[model samples]
Target: MMNHKKILGIVLLVAVSISGLFAAESANTENTVKKSTIIYTIKGNAEETYYTMMDKPIKALGYRLPDPRKHVNQVYKEQYGSTTLEVLSFMTIVNDKKVKPLLEIDPKLAGFNPFNLVIYKHQGKDETVISHLTADAIIEMLGITDQKVITEYRKQMEELDALVAKTFPSAVVSHGTYEGAVENAMMHYEITFDRPEDLDDYIDEIQEKVDDTFTEKGYIMAGFFDYKQGKPDLLPSYDAFWTFSLCHFPYSYTVFDNEGAMPEVAVFAPCTMYMYIKKDTNTLVIGMPRLANWNRFFTMNNSKRMDFLNKLDKDIPATFLEIGAIEVK
Candidate 1:
């Protein structure tokens, strides 16, 4: 009983609705990029008041806060004679148990194993920002697939997150937005060397050389942690596992503390390079998060900052090769 024109109108209406639905779905997919970093903005500037309190709680979480670089902005202000940052600092913390299961699966997991928990505040701002990478980011970035280990690690992070919330009751939590995971998130390399009669002797000799070499090249040995020696029970299967927090004084100053630069990026600063030697194995593995991650995760768009990022990406591996290590893949 319906007219032909009416039937045609009904068909047109259905087609338009379907098209709109598809368009909406596409837009949502694009907008749903995964977040890789977390930011907590807490009111009040108590300076090192909160920073010093973390030591006890961090130890309770089976983690350690090594080489706490508090008042970094003050150091910048003193050396550079001026600065934009008011409270930019870092506490490179690591949990051995979190990396124990993942380390052998992918030695590169050690790259972010000893990561930074950064605190920053902008000049004239009353709030302090504490930030770090999400556990999801770590699992994805390392290309890890073991769900059991992943779940355990995430839970560990949740415990740490709870500590933050309880410590700063009014902190506003947020995430660092990005397009998603970057390609080749970590830089990994390995070197096969002769097995020595005493492993400690080899470690001592090589460590001294590594320290001297980086220092000569104007790099700061920000901090060092030895899991095999420091926490023997945590690494039951490894002969050696250690991480060095590497920092380029000038580069850090320019990107984080200098005028017109991003201070929040310090969350990834003092890049921790990890190295390990498995039990009775002659191969020594090395890995770290590539500097390229800084630009992609943080969307730092300045040309000068990009140059620093690119140069470090190239320089880090080059330095490893220079220090008698073979590049693995």
Candidate 2:
């Protein structure tokens, strides 16, 4: 969580220099994006009913929560014996058919194929906050330009936003202004590998190395999905495509578990990194929303969070390079 009154707080402080924003467009860029994150704060703690209440409606709207990291507060408490949050969830969501059209124009959209739908309740707080990055922010970050796809995507956003309000009528809805959002917010990378007779063999070997690398760096591969499974034709642009829901425990605990730490940033938790190989190409492409985004969206006023963000922003790409991947712009 970026900033929540009765609210969100997130981390540790170390002296570290932050990186430059990915693109320089923010300078001359008109602040056309009104909000980067949308928040819905209902009067009561909707912990128990959160899922059952919105499950059907979310799916009916073409979104699916393949993996909802629910009750994460408890998971943290077990590790540290206490947590500032009573409820914290990272619901990674996707609208396959709807996103299919956009993927054709911008494969980068897969960077957030399953963006986090965040919900949190600080301990003793009576209200639950549900939030996520706005569609405009996402579309802009990916540099999406197709009008038809853009219109349809925004329409879905309206539908989803309306559904959230309908599900929690008395909720107070608000959005975080996108005044200083960094353009091209995603970190893109690529790795060229020799074509092997059996791609599975390559996947098996590299996947093991990738897992080991992240683990050694104190990162958690919380979830993995081969989007190609059962839907090979779904993404004709790629011979194989997948994503990793990555998380770093110490970083999370620092920003979210402490008594006064911000937990609302949990909405961006378990960062999703997308990987794919375009048909007829031997290069493996990868992309993920940058940790710097958390800084931009939430302003990350505290140096502690800035430290963690800076560390990971540099470390993640280095870790990939250690495994033979190259940063692409």
Candidate 3:
């Protein structure tokens, strides 16, 4: 019979080998966009055009642009002592019916359920730039492998594209590369709570506490998803789970409005912070993607960007501790 140590070594080697293969595949696809990222340029000042898009909505497009600007002007002042350009970003949530089935297939799909639209102009620029990451890029980055889901996602995105063209008749629309940034690594911070006398009540309390902490820390709670509540039939195996999309306005402005900042990085925006409990377990798990991944693949090692992300990576866990959640060892 094989010794226990030898068996453990073999399992470890296999896990590393699998991880290496996935990394290699990601490397091969870097900087190569499967779908064209469409950019629309209007012949006018950036603020005017940004408002136009904000006010105008093509209902036929099957989505509505939520009116929330991160206020980059103030963000810039706070971060860099002064502001240089105008920047605003918003999102369009596709019809819930259209996105529901996709989410039922896989909850991870929630990351792109409400696609983003960004409008901004760099200092000294004559025109505002409007852009969005391609549907193919969104699908690929989330690692969606279902052919049916991919086809449906592409179709819905195409509908949005048509609406943009119709809404901005005079604007110039062109394709560019923006597949997605490489997720070289992910940061996971989780806390497991002992099963309370009333499990449901405890989960709700925990949720409220986490949300409160995020808001107090200058983070925006953009969207909340109760995966278990929505998909009891599909997720029968899961005891209970949920994810909240959180965003820090200053952090968003830093990456979106700054010159040379890759607007495509917004794909990770309102970072999806997930909390869940596995079936038959009393443990509550919470975590979010590390902001550093933004530098790894998209921002290209910007010091300020890295600093902002690093702070988030550290502070989030500390806040969890403050709120009476224990970090998973």
Candidate 4:
């Protein structure tokens, strides 16, 4: 016959043992059901023969080198949700111009550009998919050649220059413009920056400088405008104004911020200023601004744009962990 205290102790021990057994069984079941992730690593090289056939002028121009380490690494991390699948591509030293021509010639070759696609099982039976493609790929698909593209680009750039001159005949002092090829037309300007923080002080300085040089010039500084903040590094606001001609334009004091993980290569963010000028008592529009991201130009129903986005999503994963070189066998 056991004492009452002994019986109570036995019961407590049995209860604890049973609880421990249940916990172990539950953990084992979870481990058995968890799905294993698969990573695919793909490798390939650009065709050297194709690049060799490029035109002399095109060959002479500096080529955009594909930095496998930075670009590939960054794209993998940014696009894919998991760092599991990795793609490593190499390019043979071929003429720069031939590369674009080769890609343009074949639509199927489009996937050769750095991109990623992800697929996973969802809702018991349904499959979910996502993709991403780099900006380089998008630009190539536009089928824009140097001659076809440069002509329109130069015209817009020149118009912008003329507008600046007409707006600030005296204060303009010295101005210069640079041209480059990006996803869209690119232009750079070097204007006078007298004061640092005080926009009012800068405007006053510009006005005084202009007035002293061109006494009778029809130029006056309009009030400043503020821009809504977007992606921190991509869009930075400084000071903007409307000219006496009623044109709205904004000039940024900060050049570019390169402190973050990714540096902004463009000299200036897309600055669209509306200028209303009086031409014989009627306001004539002068400047039509455009942004660097060409995708925004098309309507939502555009198939090309949709395809581009789809390809991008496929190549790039939705999460950071999915970024990495996968061994594609």
Local error of candidate 1 at 196, Å?
Answer: 1.2
Per residue, candidate 2 scores C-alpha lDDT tens digits across 101-154 of 677777777776788888898888789999888888878777777887778788
Worst 10 residues of 2 by lDDT: 10-19
- Give per-residue lDDT, candidate 4, residue 284: 19
* Candidate order by decreasing lDDT: 1, 2, 3, 4
CA lDDT for candidate 2: 0.79
Model 4 residue runs over 4 Å out of place are: 1-70, 73-75, 78-191, 195-293, 297-329
Cα misplacement distance, residue 173 of candidate 1 (Å): 1.1
lDDT of 4 by residue, 183-285 (tens): 4332111242334454455445544543333223221222222111122221122133222111111111011111121111111112222222121222112
lDDT of each: 0.80, 0.79, 0.65, 0.27
List TM-score per model, in order.
0.86, 0.86, 0.67, 0.18
Q: Please identify model 3 stretches exceeding 4 Å from their true place.
A: 1-37, 46-60, 64-67, 70-81, 92-94, 174-181, 184-200, 216-218, 222-243, 256-267, 274-289, 314-329
Global fold similarity of model 3 (TM-score): 0.67
255: Cα error in model 3, Å: 3.6
C-alpha RMSD by candidate, in order: 5.5, 13.2, 8.7, 26.6
List, residue by residue over 60-138, the lDDT tens digit for candidate 1. 8888876788788888888889888778778888877676776666566677767888888888888888889988877
Query: Model 2 misses residue 89 by how many Å?
Result: 1.2
**58: Cα error in model 1, Å:** 2.8
* lDDT of residue 131 for candidate 1: 85
- Where model 1 places Cα greater than 4 Å from the true spot, the runs are 1-31, 101-106, 230-234
In order, how many clashes per candidate?
0, 12, 0, 47
